[model samples]
Target chain A: PQNNKSVHCHHPCKNIHVFQKVAGIVIGKSDVKSFPDRKNIGVDRFTFSFTVKDSPDFFINVTAWGNDGYINLLSGSFSVGDCVVIENPLVATKDPEKGERFCPTTPSHYRLLVTEAHSQVYLCADIDTMDRLLPLIHLPVKDSRDFYSLGDIVANGQKLDGTVINVLAAVKSIGEPKQFTTSDRRKGQRLEVKLFDDSVSSLPLVCWDREAIQLVQTLIPKETVLFIADVKISFDSFRNSMAATVNSKTIITVNPDTREASLLFSYAKEASESGALDQDEKPEDAKTIINIVMFLDSITDVYTVTQLKEKAQENPEAFFGITYSFISKLDLDSSVSKVIRTRCTRCKLQVMEETQSCPNQLCPGRDQAFSASTGFDLLVDFTDHTGTVHGCALRSPMAEQALGCTTNEFTMLTDDQRTAMKWKFLLERCKIYVKILPSTKMRTGIRGVILACTRADPGEVKQHMSALLQRL
Target chain B: RQTQETLTKKPAVENSLRILTAVIDGMRHWSQFKDKVPYLFEIFATLDSAVTVGRHGAKNFLMRDGKEVVQCVFYENEQELPRLIRGQVHRCVGNYDRSTDVLVCVSVRPGLPSELRNAQEAVKACDAEMRVLVKSISEV
Candidate 1:
């Protein structure tokens, strides 16, 4: 009954329900600005620019004005390179006097305005369109742009006059957000964050007002790449280093879609991987194993070899399960020969038989009595009709399960006996569940190492086999 | 006296047998044969020469049905397969092989019935065509 109503648009004002929606990818953003309203109360303005999807040459500028709540929502939701749709928008012509003076440069004459009550902005999830426009969205800086590094600013110790410079860096650390009273008795928040680039030196970036509080609450240092635009450079005499002061017109982008941001991300990833940074300074992916372990504990979603490969390529940090039929033991003789090795229980480092102690000084076994444990490295080939993969199951628990014997008993067996046992237990024609841990060497690559292996329940396998047989 | 007793009971047994025969006829007509048993039949316009391997006592053959070319493997445990002659239609039943894209035939019988003669003609029209719809055995 509600759908039967006829929609009508009024003549003078742009009707809220009849306006055409604009679809494009965000390419640039301006800094947040506050202006006085009719009652002299301050309101925030958030503006961004985007290129039309069908016509990339045409750029549209969007201004969300007069409401701090709507401005904050837009600021938190929209980012560059995100394809978005703004519905029921109010299109207005740009004033000639304000031409070229706007912060985010746009090519089109028309501008769009959206408010919380009259408009809606939806971030598009079209991955293909985003991929196509990814490399095309260039920053609006000049071709001969001379950006200064943190090292250059610190060495110069003096500000360059009438020059606006940009710095592309990753957030290295963040200080606690503190509230401070301004000269006019207005309460404001301040936060100091450390930023690093490909250079050897780093800069201390000070943010004030709402931005400081937002950074302290949302940003994860060393993981978030930041592009600081139009910030005034100054020398901190007390620390004797260069610092950048964030102001009302300074635009700060977190993980923006730009070549420089990607480069900084790769640098941060490399630093985290090479152990050049501290343990606590590692990137978010370093904690993926713990997240995956927690995720796998609650759910059981078995993936095929092909599905596992595709999923691993998408997100290599997540653990996946593969149901595979046992093929054959690959390099059985070589694997069994080096199966048993003495390792420190605490450090898991291979301890030499002569030392009779753990080599790692930090390990508890170094000071205590020698606590040795046996470990195994078993590699086998498995297949699931669709594809074949080499599964490497390491350590004692997996070895005990695969060999059907305890590690102590296995160590006491002769080499020939171990080989025989491997042949006997590994060749069964049954379905098995294998947990795959992605290799760190190839990020977003398909190859994974088998972390654990266990035979599936016979009853469940029978049901699966019957279902498969019916399909066949 | 025993013959006389059997004769007296024969009519009742015959009546029950007639009802059983009617039920079997209804089931045969209503139920699809392919759905009951996993079987496939294909007419081949041409078949490759069968090669017998001594190691596994297996014979491998390649044939083209209407849709695609399929490889057929028969083991010693199954009945021996006659030599594949070109331009002759044969019926095959087996599980599908996903790995090698082959049909592992358990039973290969030569010649199509009169009802399937049109299928044989269709195969002849399209040279080296696949006529079978067997699912892959490795899928199981």
Candidate 2:
């Protein structure tokens, strides 16, 4: 702690000598400002606001002037959260005549000037202690001035004659980067990115030149939330929609340190994973159904119950297809009835037992078995060694195959024969494919629907048992 | 054309059967018994810990092997569960609950391993108790 010695520097104080050090967290930074000196040469000034360790509430503005390399290093290496100790800094009063006191717009009466003679800047490594003082460093809220939601910007109709606005949004989708010729005949790269806000409305953002290249390098759709500032808005006549164009001054921050950015990223991730964005608040279009079919077709791995439970936690609304062998049926309660029934083929409405007529009035045969189908609802408990879960095998083509005979044939059999059939077929060890749908209601667990079932071959089961014994 | 189709179909069917046989041959644990009949096997484990909830809720017990912990959920059915004293070795078997995040015992029988008599003697020397659920044994 050699440099831990405290020095007293306060308001109405004299300028400090060279080699004096001060430590603080960099709270704010201004864009590079250029000015012409007395020699008529262009000079670049970089200003940063910091809350000193000695007086946490008092901000001290630090201004540095240098060449491109020095300015770039100061801005690039240090960000808003960094704690730095500037060595050999000159504490100076602002010039009232030139209005330099208001140059950085900080509340402090005095400022620090860093020049070539005293430009030793040390970035501090002790962040844990500095984090405690972060509450003292106050940054003015700029959301009202700079930030605009897509819904608000659209409703305002400010882009009628092309207005530039700042927005904080998450990139929902991005097109492949492509090289294109600019209107000036120069070759440049451009890409189209779709940005969405909490309003659920989306707007197209076009990134050109260097920004497009940077976006291609760092942007991950549905994961990266960006803070895009000062983007030019233009109405596309052909599409009859508003779009944002990236220009040189547009400041693009990927995954910025902001609460809104984190919230937007999580929302985008959940919507994308659960397919909620497509299914919710939209008509049942062919495209939406096709997306679900594609997702179902893409599933190839057979997951155990433990894996399925974890998947349910990650995306609660998504359905997972699982294959398991039948272990046994749980003991039936009073609610479960061992009754055979007939149902309408089209609507699946049950028919009267005595008349064998469809109960549904819309059936083609008003009151006859000709328009109805026969099948039974079964709830069987299954296990794959990991856990036990109950699944409903609805009366479908797969259920009929599992039962070994058509529902109509089973309905015609005597009660004694039906009981024997249940023992021979339903109670036997077999493979069943089921689609497990997670319960939408909180804490209700998962529900499974059997899609297909097949009996286990005797020879294969024998071979499997032998191999399993060897492993044990 | 019909003969050529039948020749192609015959080889495809034979190839499928060969693949099915290979898949069956790879079966080891109860977790691998998807679409296949389950084989009864016993697990010799130390009952390291136990957690019991309300009267209606199932009791969760743990058996550990330093690296992995197999959780057993014991439900009170027609038969009552024998008191499980901790840190004692026991041999048990029942249906495996694969859907659970942890390894669970759908049912279990407490007994000495018929195959590993010497190991059972060692476990008995360590003061292991027989705490089988009677219903699980009866069902098997």
Candidate 3:
């Protein structure tokens, strides 16, 4: 049995067996370059180099269209004397005469294609040649200072890529005429961007039309790391390097759809150090329950978000908390367990809990029930303000029965008891007002109300609260 | 009147004219009363801006500032009605309680009669269109 120990991995590589069958490693690096094809193919031979542990140094030849526009992208003038970590590169065969070739392992002539390369171009030593680059491993870039003098692309004779950049600009409303012109003249158009940062000087950044334009438009603000790919920056008409414009063919994209927080987990390190037996075993069910507890605890602890605006600002974290709780609860009960009690697929009648055979006579779904949990019966019980209920949750005909002469008639009742549990529980802890909606699935003449809870600003708890409330 | 007669037509030109007429009617009512009275046009538009144009025209009233808005009906649709408009940049013509089905008149705007005719036509077309979508569905 082949194990991952055989391959020397510098970066996180999971499911090594899955990659074994793959011909070439699907790389996430953006070391694309376009140069004029002086050797004859009428296209520039683009070279992209990346590295992997135990695997031979790999390079990919990219054919970039060389127009007067790609002149900036073609000029690879960065001084490369820095140590770098090239991820998951595979050695691919290449020929000076041929456009494409198959992957061969017998010391064939090939170019090195790097996957997800992380590098600082001007580090302590010159590590470009693959032979001399074996021993030294580059460290992670920590701050803005670490990128200083990391000579790669000289934007106006200076390093302009590693700036702590922040931009506040509206979606540029470009007319159809200008939109048409980019496809006609440059093969890519530009957006007039107004950029800003805490730095003393700001300038227009003429971004190549490929990736950067999309990045500027789609990227949600407050992203920790910006993975920019295939973009060439020129001083814009405003002469501000910060005021950038994206041209066509210049691609600006990132590794992940990075809107939310990205928490990297090193499970390999955990499993290796903690013990493989623990890793191999299914996780304990309490893990999810504990997460739910933690989420509820976090929301209760938040005292600062008193106003709706403040609460709305904290809504993301609040929703994240709710999500973690709900997901944890969901994880506790597998789908198989949920279907322990079945219902009829057609008439929607309750069947046996273990087997989905309905006991109802003359019912279409009788003796052909699906699952107990599959039955659309709602169970609601009135709970005190503390969210602890007084009576047990009902099922069947009893669950469908309405309330009889209660002091809290105004308290809303929902169709689903679990949904009510979540709402009432949250409402009890906070000032959120919720009204349960009537369900068509529910039997007629049944009125349900779990309890009364005050209303909070909808905008504040809106994200965390289930959309079910809206439907109700 | 000519525009109102062509409300059910699918031509973009007619549609735009009908929409414009509805807006003009809503604007007229919007300009009339000083006490911020809620008009019938505003009430219908509050329920569904794109529903029956007659209803929408009736519902299509305005608040003080000019951006278009209608009352959010949570009770009828079983949806959560937005209580407070997040930003105060725009004014609301009416406030609706999803549970109580109560509509409170917040502001007023007088509109032109020509716009009312346009709104009426647009609404009639919308109702007919809904009937078509509903007619196509076969019950299981």
Give stretches of model 1 more than 4 Å off.
Answer: A1-19, A25-36, A39-60, A66-83, A92-102, A107-110, A115-120, A123-146, A159-162, A209-220, A223-225, A247-472, B1-140
lDDT of each: 0.51, 0.51, 0.28
What interface-residue Cα RMSD does candidate 2 give after superposition? 15.6
Q: Once model 1 is optimally superposed onto the true structure by TM-score, how far is the C-alpha of residue A252 displaced, in angstroms?
A: 4.5
Error of 3 at A369 (Å): 27
Model 2 agreement with the true structure over A1-472: per-residue lDDT tens digits: 0122223455412222322766666654544444445454565444433323333334566767655567666656665555777776666665555434324334456666665555677677776746754543333223423677766555543222257667778777787665544446555566788777666435678876452355445678777777766677764422324578876435455675667777777888887788765564354223323322232343344554445655665775545354434445632221223434555654466666554555555543342234554455666666533344655544444455456665567657765566455444333435555556677653426676665556645343444344333433
Instruction: Note the clash tally of each candidate.
Output: 11, 7, 69
DockQ of each: 0.01, 0.02, 0.02
Looking only at chain A, give the TM-score of model 3 against the true structure: 0.23
Chain A TM-score values, per prediction: 0.41, 0.37, 0.23
Which of candidates 1 and 2 reaches a greater DockQ? 2
Docking tier of model 1: it is incorrect
Candidate 1 lDDT (Cα, whole model)?
Answer: 0.51
- The model with the greater TM-score, 2 or 3, is 2
